[model samples]
Target: MPICTATLALGSVSGSLLFSNTDIASSNLHSSSVSSLLSPVSNFSKHSQRYCCSSRRTPWVCSANKVTSNTEINGQTSPVLQDSSVPPTEAVRQARRSADWEAARSYRDSGFICEGRIEGFNGGGLLVRFHSLVGFLPFPQLSPSHFCKEPTKSLQEIAKGLTGSLISVKVIQAHEESRKLIFSEKEAEWSKFSGKIKVGDILEARVGSVEDYGAFVHLRFPDGLYHLTGLVHVSEVSWDLVQDVRDVLTEGDEVKVKIISIHREKSRITLSIRQLEEDPLLETLEKVIPQDGSVGSDSESISDASNIEPLPGLETILEELLQEDGIIDVRICRQGFEKRVVSQDLQLWLSNAPPINQNFTLLARAGRQVQEIQLTTSLDQEGIKKALQRVLERVP
Candidate 1:
């Protein structure tokens, strides 16, 4: 039996072969024929030795010491050999797996994580982690009640607790590779709000700041400090001319307001404070005395003789009118008249009196010099007297 290690090319086998030491001399084959048959094997051994030992390398090689043998089948001789070598396939697979694992570890090591604490806050937003990675928590994101007209003292008090507390966060965004980190305590709070709060909820808030244009407020809510500030536009603050907002509302005032809108993605909360109070203008107009100066018989208009032209003694009339009405420190300007009235009401009176059109100017002496006022509207005599009386009463 011949032990066969075959290199198959399609359906046929070829290559060198080896055999054990067994020999039989055949009567039909001459010695020369045997020598000729072995000659090819000898030459094959020399070629194989040169191929294996040569500096020009290949993937496989055969050692020379092994004896070569030959067998005949179908008039063709096949060479057999003892030793051959080729690289194993398993080494390549192991290398690829190692490379993949290393890449994954490298990615994990390079990822970013942030940690800080909340600090101070303002009407516009919260100021946190000052002097060490300060972050802003906008009013809406701070809490679900962030949209209240005014944030409560409790919310602010909770914000106070945020200071110096360690907060773990991630670097969700970066700007031009800068060290600046945009953080949100409110972002974390939003999930809780979505679960708890619904549309059309009423909340209490505190006035944070009042501007000529509007007012800012903070709202109290769970999850974080939230604000529900909005504009109490000069028009909305009062129907009367609002020369300044500070005159109406100041910081830290408590107010009840309603939520008009909540934009969770944009993190905005709209609130209204004026809705809580009665319209001041309507109240004033309803209470105002008419120009004719008749108030249910108790109030009466001045006599017609009071309107007539008079003698030099009329100066006394003017003096009596001033004394009885108690008008003082009168100043007139192009638009109207300004005067201090000495009365219980202590009101400041401004009016455009007779012979005054939009272009008409007036001059009046309060104490020393005459001041000028251009009239903006025609005045009603009864209304003027009544207004003067009101002012005089109000003056200290």
Candidate 2:
């Protein structure tokens, strides 16, 4: 047989096959002869296929492996064998740390420390001063347990008292461009008071501010923070007319109050100074004296008698006229007639009284008088007299 040469293109190798007539006739002599030659060559190609290896990207491969098998490539399996031992990239690790640091810095920069002092105000809000800059303490933020309900006058008084007091406060915020520091005495007090206070507790406080309608009292037990300041309304402070809050209370006036409400999370306190005093209605009722004088006597008359009873004689007839309509203790006077009636129906009765004759005049105790009523001569005097008598008979 002639010599036959087969050049295989395995990996980068490229060639062709050359076979003589004698070699073909020999390979075709039997099926097993053809298989033996082809099987050995196919097995060698599978084992000798070379794979390029790379460590920089994913799916690292080894060049020693002639048989190619696919592994991770572009995050998926490739048609070549690869190394599975490569570690994560350094850039990814650095990016994660950078993200963590940025998150921390953002959290740090979101908070700040501010400083301010209590300034004068009247009812609207507390004025705070910081290095010639001004801020506001809304009524809601003025105290830990007490909120000023009607703050108009109270703020004014508080502003007056805070004028010279050196106060320390927390920075709620800072207006950098304005150079304004928003401070909160309430917030500082809340840090200490949130744990101690509850609703319905009575507290002793000082009057830090007063207004036409109310007063702000600094609580003693809760510390000297303005957040613990209790409010005493003008109506709550006294039963008398409160033309001005300054009349009854001044700054630094120590007083007692009650805690009406508390908002812990919001750090709000609602206090009442009036709760320390007796209710005005109850007090006045307790002091009221029982009636003791005769119903028709001078002592029984109102202190002002311009509307009191007329002469006793006229009172008898007036009582008769009033009795017809369930009126009692009827009193006739020059200025006006007065009586206590069960119903308003007595007005009609007064409009129908018999006209007076001869302009007669009469006097009664408490310096009241009964003037004459104009009448017609033809009117029946005896019938009118009988009508009066009949009306009196129906009264108890």
Candidate 3:
């Protein structure tokens, strides 16, 4: 029989190995063909700094037949190893995993796209065979193409149809200490089109899904297909207050959104639907308040003389606050808050929430620079907690 003549080297000795493709299963070690394993090993060795057998099961090492410790090849003899000199199984596994982590880190740093096959999935996400070690592809990291309009389709139902499918993904995170590898298909898609788009660019989008916090929208590319996804936060859903995000947008809703911000490194896009339209609050009160950088016209200025308005209610409160040190602007956003018993006040603050009645996020200016901005409320901290709880309850 003709012997298989694929190559392997030990130190200075370089010669053809006796083992072949069929040798692992066969009683005879050198009788089978070795050509099948040659290509993969050759490709791997070209890039790796160190050479060793494949980091997989390594069945050949455990095979019944063993090569003699003393073998001469091309007039160069390799050093003979004693029985105790072999590396431990756990040590070899750790080394292999360490190398894989480093390789994954490099891929993340370089934004390289990798193809992995879905082996299976669990509640957490899809498990992919990323080269040698298994990697995780979280549901949130999935591309919009994987989602369908069917509301009945659960996460498991969506992922169930994707098993054995090959997917292009990027290594979003690789932590050696935690031994975690997080992959993202959306990031892979982002790398392709992020350069073509930018912040403030209006784009057509189709809503992928709706949650209380925001709606996920897929940005349509020039080719008329959704390529990237961005989140339209609830506050950005409309010019008016958004009680619930689902009230404004839903799955498959076709809309045009303005890109408010783009995070290229993190592969995130912040979109705004309200920005496409004028802010109703600002528009309704435009004559009352001046635009950002321009001073108000004398005729429309709120502070302009108005025969003294012949009115002076609670002028003492304003007079006392304005008299305080470094208190330049004392504009009141809202007034005439309804008074109620402490119990009723607590209930309404919890139910209607965010303590909208209270003054929040106002800064006092000193000279030309602004000073401390405070977030205080008429109700205590528990009211804030209840308000947040109510908000989170509406999130999908």
User: lDDT for each of the candidates?
Assistant: 0.38, 0.41, 0.54
Which window of ten consecutive residues has the lowest lDDT sum in model 1? Answer: 48-57
Candidate 1 structure quality by residue, lDDT tens digits, 1-396:
111111111211012111111211321334553343221111112121111100111223556655455544324454444343321221222232233233223322443333344444434444433121233444433543433423355556655655445543332322212222344444444434434444456666677667777777666555344523343454445433345778887877776766666777665566665556665422321223223432322212222322323222223423433443323322232111123322222122223223333233322222211223233333343434444444334543
In model 3, where do residues sit more than 4 Å from their true spots? 1-105, 148-152, 174-179, 208-213, 281-396
Superposed on all Cα atoms, the candidates' RMSDs to the truth, in angstroms, are 29.4, 32.7, 13.9
In candidate 1, stretches whose alpha carbon ends up further than 4 angstroms from where it belongs are 1-172, 186-202, 221-229, 260-265, 283-396
Residue 85 accuracy (lDDT) in model 1: 31
After TM-score superposition, what is the CA distance of residue 193 in candidate 3 from its true location, in Å?
A: 1.7
Which candidate ranks first by TM-score, i.e. highest? 3
How well does model 1 score by local distance difference test?
0.38
lDDT of 3 at 304: 30
Q: Which stretches of candidate 2 lie over 4 Å from their true place?
A: 1-171, 174-185, 222-227, 263-268, 284-396
- Per-residue lDDT tens digits for candidate 2, residues 74-154, read 244434433222223222322333332332233224432233444344344454543323444554455533323223444
lDDT of 1 at 320: 36
**Best-performing candidate as measured by lDDT:** 3
